[model samples]
Target: MKRFVVCKTCGARVSGLLDSPVALDFITKAEQELLSGGEYGNGDNGNVYISTSDKHHLSYHQDQNRLIGCCGPSPYGLPNLVCICKSEIGREVTDCCTAHYVMLYKERIAIREDNTGLLEKVVSLPVAEDLKSQYEILINFGEIEIVLNALKM
Candidate 1:
C-alpha cells in the first residue's frame, strides 16, 4: 500500500510519503527575514523538511517563476509551485541553500491512501452519520493507524 501528499484544494500530487524526513536548521539571513513576514511564514510555525535527493517525489509548476526571495545564482530561496487551483502547496529548497530540504505546508496538503481496503471501508460507510464518528472508527480500528505509524518511522 502506498500513500501520497496531495494538494488539499485541487488534489494535485505534491510528493510521495517521505521515507525519512530530515530536520533542518539552515535558514539564511535573508530567508530568516522573509520567513518573518511572508504569506506562509510565521515566527512560530513548524516545517516538514524533506531532502533534495527526494526531489523526484515533488512536482513543480511549469511557469518556472521564482518566489520573492528565490532568485540569483545561489537562488537558495523557494520556488513558486502552486496547485492547479492557484493555491500555494509547498516549496522546493534549492541546492544553493546550505540545507537540501523541501518545506511543505502541512495545512495545505493532505495524506491520501492508495490502498483498496481503506477506500472500500470508506465507500461502504453510510453518509448520514456524523463524520466525527466515522473518523473515530477508522482511527481506532482500521488500517489508517498502521499507515500513520509507518510514516512516523
Candidate 2:
C-alpha cells in the first residue's frame, strides 16, 4: 500500500511519500521559528510537504516570474515545479525567510499506488465512483492471479 506522488500531466514519479508528511503549519512558520521548535500540520491548508532529497523527474519552472525568490522560489506564488512536459506541478519554498520544502498541489499531482510491485494502480484522489470500482476489480484480479500461481505449485 505504498503511495507515490506523481505529475498529473505526464505521470512521472515525483517523490515517495515522506515517512511523515511535513505539514503546512511548518511551511508557514518563519525560518527562526522552524529552526527552534516548530510544530507541523497544525494549520488548515493541509498541504503535504516533501524534502528535496525525495524529489525526482521534476524540474524548476521555466518562467522567470514564477522563479522569483530571495534565496529560492517563493512558495506563496504559483507552482515553481514542473514535469518534463512543462505542466505546473507544485511549489518549492526555499525563501531565506521561511522554512524550505516542496508542496505538491493536490490538483496538479496524483497518488499512485504500488501494490506488490507487480502491477501499478494509478488512482487519483477524489476518485470517481466508476473508477473506484474498476480499481477494486484490478486489485482483486491481482490477488486471484497470485492464488492461481500458488495453486500451480
Candidate 3:
C-alpha cells in the first residue's frame, strides 16, 4: 500500500511515504476548517506538509540566494525544492529556528501506488545471482505467486 508523491509537471518521484499528513499544530482554526472533511492538498490552495526527512529526488533551488541561511537553508521566501527536470516543486524548511518539514504545493504533485513487489519479496532468496532472471520471468508473465510460494519453500 506504499504511495509515492510525484511531480505533476515532470512525473519525477519525490517521496515514498505519503502517510504523514500536515499536523494540527501548524494549521490555524480557519485552515483547519478548510481541511475538515478531506486531507491536506485536496483543495486549490493548501499544501501537503511532510517531514523534511521523507523527501527524495528533490534538490535545493539552484539560486544560492534562495538557500542562504544560518544553520540550514532559510525557511522563508520561495519554494526551495525542484524536480529533476528543474521545475520548482516545493518548500523545505529546515533552519535551526523552525520545525523541519516540507510543504509540497497540492496542485504541483500527484500520488501513485507502488505495486511492484517482486524484487523486494525475493531479495532475501539464497539464489542472489539468479534473482535478476527470476524477476524478469515473473514480470514477463505477470505472476508473483511463484515467488511467494518459493519464499514458503
Candidate 4:
C-alpha cells in the first residue's frame, strides 16, 4: 500500500511515499561514520536527513541571485524548504554532495496511509478523534533510522 507525505500543519500533500536507494546508501555511510566518532554538522547536533527525489509538489525560493533548492540552505544558512504556508518543512540536501535527494525533517511532515484500499473497508474503521495524530503513525519503508534520527534533532 502506498502512503502520502503531507504537511502536518496544513494537511497539504507534499508528495507520495517513494524510496530512494541512493539516499539509503548515503545515510548508511553517514551512520557508520558517526558511529566511528567522525563529526557531521555541528558538534553533537548532526543534521538528520530524509532523501527524496520528488519536488513537484514543493516550491523553491531564491536568495540574492541564486535559486534555492527545495530543501537547500537559505541565505541565512538555515534549511529553506517551506510549505506554501511558510512553514519550514525540510531542506534540499543534494547540494551537500552529488546525491540526488532532499533532506526532509520528519517532524515537519506527516505520514498517512493512502487509504487506497476498498472504500467500504476504510470507512468501517473507527473514526479517529484527532485525524492528524492518527496519520502521524510512522510507517517503516526500510528507512526507520532516518525518521527516528530526524525526531531526535
lDDT (0 to 1) per candidate: 0.47, 0.59, 0.61, 0.44
Per-candidate clashes, comma-separated: 0, 0, 0, 3
| Candidate 4 structure quality by residue, lDDT tens digits, 31-112 | 1221111111211223333334344256654442233444433223455567766677766544333343444556677655
Off by over 4 Å in 3: 20-22, 27-44, 115-153
Worst 10 residues of 4 by lDDT: 34-43
Pairs of residues at least 3 apart in sequence or in different chains that clash in candidate 2: none
Q: By descending lDDT, how would the candidates be arranged?
A: 3, 2, 1, 4
Q: How accurate is candidate 4 locally (lDDT)?
A: 0.44
Off by over 4 Å in 4: 17-23, 27-52, 62-76, 117-153
Clashes of 1: 0
User: Could you tell me the TM-score of candidate 2?
Assistant: 0.60
Over the stretch 28-114, how does candidate 2's per-residue lDDT look in tens digits? 665523322111222245454566555666888877788898887766788888877788887777778787667777777766666
- Cα TM-score per model: 0.43, 0.60, 0.60, 0.47
The residue-by-residue lDDT of candidate 1 on 67-149, one tens digit each, is 43333213344445566567766676543334334566778776555554443343335654355334434543555775445
User: Residue 3 of model 1: what lDDT?
Assistant: 46
